[model samples]
Target: MELKQLEYFIVVCEQGSFNRAAECLYTSQPNVSKVILSLERELGRPLFERSPRGLRITPYGRTVREYARVVLRHTAIIRSMADYGWGKKFSLATYPSNMIAHLLADFYTHWQERYVVEHYEGTVEEVSGLVARGQAELGIVYVAQRQLSSFRHILSHKKLVFQPLDVKEACIYVGPHHPYYVRDSIDFSQLSSQRFIGGVHDYFAVEHHLERVSLGAISTRDLNYAMHSNSDHVIISALLHTDLCSLGLNFMHQPYSHYDIKTLRINGCEPFLTIGCIRQEGEPHSEAADWFVEQFRQLL
Candidate 1:
């Protein structure tokens, strides 16, 4: 029932053993067990079941784990604020592509003196989940390839807002040895016979754009999968070594132009994606969050 009890429960769930949890909490195993027993008695359900290897969370325990994570994250945020004399620490979730491309570096560089910035990288769906659950103060994501309708629906229900920052194009690229490299412009029809490496899910813009190009129109069976990864670096690396073509944000390639690669213009398709920030609608943003947004706005 107590916050400390919830903390202990989470520790046990994560560590998977009473002894390990006790060591982590810096408390005696007996005390940890007693507290867990009391918590189970109050809840009237066993939170964990012991197995040969270690403790396993029960079905009910899984539900409790979600709430426990939220509570613990918020508690730590509160404690961090208090420890810093109420100064704000901005927690942001971003996609891997944005992080690798240094999109946030300028903002962080100029604002770190005034705000504490924390960054997390994941797929668009994962980032959305973090923002929805209040784990992150805000999230930056690409909107074109993801199912924005579903995100809109979920955010509307949760009283969250998604605001557009900028609209940018993504381009297709191949290594220097590819046939497309010798041409000033390559016909889109040529792609029908080529293997295209693309993002699979939650990358709404990329996926939707590819869908329009009839990704499945080309036979994947004969197509060599150069690589399938959520990380931009991995995809780029794959394209560098093989004749495979990849779609990427235009800005992502500008910095790496020195590398040996050829960019192909896909006629009839703009290949644009919108980048934006998402946050809870009514929740008050911390000072750090406000400053970070302000800096980002200036950059845009």
Candidate 2:
């Protein structure tokens, strides 16, 4: 019925006497006898034939003893593996996330050395789909407030779990060579006269906020769109060595080899996107997946 009961049974069979079995178990003879009786009653069979000479193991007793020993051995192996941090390989998905890139870099540097990490990159919806369809154990994706309703609908339809993370503020990145780089920060109106690069939506988000400020400049229409590309490397490279600037997440303001990224905050707004992690809702999964999520929560 229990590991201790099996242990007492084995000892009684080997020692042949209740007195000797109690000595081997370091307990009173009465306690040893009680445990064996309980085990025999729970099993619906007598494990030993009582005799004044000693105890004799029955055929059914041998069958249980062999299997019980095997169970204990397997349990020990499982505990050892858990104690040593032996975790299963986990597949993770994210939608072109620099946040996850930094988080993963920190994850590798900090703990759990034996885990195998598999990372996949895709569109935000695609990443969510991966977790929904059971292709990935976890996913990280970003959604602005306006898109939250629909995103939640999609996740619910797929039966996935999600928790929103910190908001990623939006900002404009400029090169060291740019004139505005000399100032500690630039005004909201400064963007109206500047040329920009990167996604049109990013520029418009900044422009919309600037319009609300109404510094007598109702039109961000004059703001030049010098370049438009989805590639961060290309935009960052051009911004670094050239006069062109790009709108980006505030966290993206990191230094490159030859230049440091400088950001200018808008006068009245902190334009931000909410990021969240998603996973299957009811699937049987590994503890390693939970551990990985904790690492992100602690660090990010």
Candidate 3:
């Protein structure tokens, strides 16, 4: 019924013993039992079944435990906003992208007075985890259109919400020397032997676990990976100077135009990339986060 009750209930469920939960909560076992009883009376259901050996969560308790976790997480966010001064710092995490780094740099030019601006770039999964764990105030990420349903389910289970900023059709980027440079469109089958340059943490990496689930049967492993690097300069250099190619959204065409890089559509593969920002669910965005979102939206 109360936040304290829900908090204690979750600890009890995790610890599996009232005494252990009380110790974790820095309270007495009798007090923990009293609170649990009060919560059980209000809900009219036994949260846990006690035995001589230990305690086991009931069927209803399993379900309520998840809800309690979400509620406590949101409550913590609310309290953080109230007690912690926002002017002290702002943190953001994003998937490795040049445009996002540029946007953050631009934001810094205008708002550097706000001390301790933290920025992190990683793969999609890492970005989502950062925001979910409250290590970052906001996260910018992209999900393939085909993967949106599964991605949404993952975010929901993590108690995070995603807001779409823009959607762009998928494209394969290549340099002038590449054979596909003059082509208007190419199929995924044609690139089976082509070399690729991608971020170390990107789907191109062999260690990425979500590629198959996100990209369906076609994966970067099907291609001949020439190199993997985290540096944008290194990846772009390979893409421009070698026969290597990279997968990206159509929006990248303009940015790399001066380098004579081409963004060609993949034939019969209409997969779109949806760029979005994520935050902890049920928690309102702070003023700084809103401003960053606005700037990012404008950039898109």
Candidate 4:
């Protein structure tokens, strides 16, 4: 009935045991049980079924659990907004690639006068999941043309809208010492036999572009992991030293070109990926979210 009681009920249901839930909530088991029993007494129906296997929410409890989650999320949002009003603090989530290049710095500097920024970096899927769970208000990710359908499912389930920020061709690059650096472009046939240093986090973006351009038909070279790393620095370091090639946006190519690395344009291939922002659809975002989105738009 009360917010505290509802919170306790939800935690118990999630933990599946009174003792576990009590530990999680940092309270005694008897207190947790008292709250749950009081809540059931007030509702005139049992909310859970208990057995040796642990606890299971009853049909009635399941229905309440869904609404309870919404209530808790809204409450947290209200608290966040209140804190922002007292002192400008905002949280954001993005992919590793974006952060590596300081893509969001301009926005952060502009908003620093009015807000404090807390940034989180993760894989594209992980970023989407955080947004879906209300852990983050916004997310940015790069999506290959081929992975559009998979992204659509994420957007659909999360009830989020995707807005494209920029699109650029994905080019192949090798270290400065590689023989390909002397040429403006390399033939697909030449690369077919070469080992590729693909990013695990951006594999979808890489694979989708390769398939679209029929890169597989040229030669059957095995993909070799010269160095596997999610960090952009490590990936770039590996690409700068060996015959292994990497695929990335055209804009990102120029900065690395000075390191003796060069990018080759794929013939008949539109190796482009889109960078975009995602926000939950039909949900009211905080004022901070609005300001951040506007800043991103300006940068794009």
**Candidate 4 local lDDT, 1-300, one digit each (tens):** 688988998899888899999999999999999999999999999999978887788999999889989898788756654444444566667765642345456556666677666666677777776777666778877787667777878689878778788776656777776667677766665555566766554544454455455545342233344555666677767777766777665554233235656667765455457878778888778788877677555555
State the lDDT of candidate 1 residue by residue for 131-157, as single tens digits: 876768888777763456776787788
Q: Higher TM-score: candidate 2 or 4?
A: 4
* Comparison by lDDT, 2 against 4, better one: 4
How many collisions per candidate?
Answer: 7, 0, 0, 2
Residue 270 displacement (Å), model 1: 2.4
**TM-score of every candidate:** 0.63, 0.54, 0.61, 0.60
Q: Name every residue pair that clashes in candidate 2.
A: none
lDDT: worst 10-residue window of model 2: 250-259
Q: Per lDDT, what order, best first?
A: 3, 4, 1, 2
In TM-score terms, candidate 3 sits at 0.61
* Model 3 misplaced stretches (Cα beyond 4 Å): 1-87, 182-184, 201-221, 253-260
- lDDT of all predictions, in order shown? 0.70, 0.69, 0.77, 0.70
The C-alpha stretches of model 4 lying farther than 4 A from their native spots are: 1-86, 98-100, 201-203, 214-222, 241-243, 253-262, 284-300
Instruction: Please tell me which predicted candidate would have the highest TM-score against the true structure.
Output: 1
Higher-ranked by lDDT: 2 or 3: 3
Writing each residue's lDDT as its tens digit, candidate 2 over 62-181 gives: 998898888876666454334323645577887544456666666566545666666777666677777875667888766665567777887898998777866765566788877888
Task: Estimate the TM-score for candidate 4.
Answer: 0.60
Error of 4 at 165 (Å): 3.2
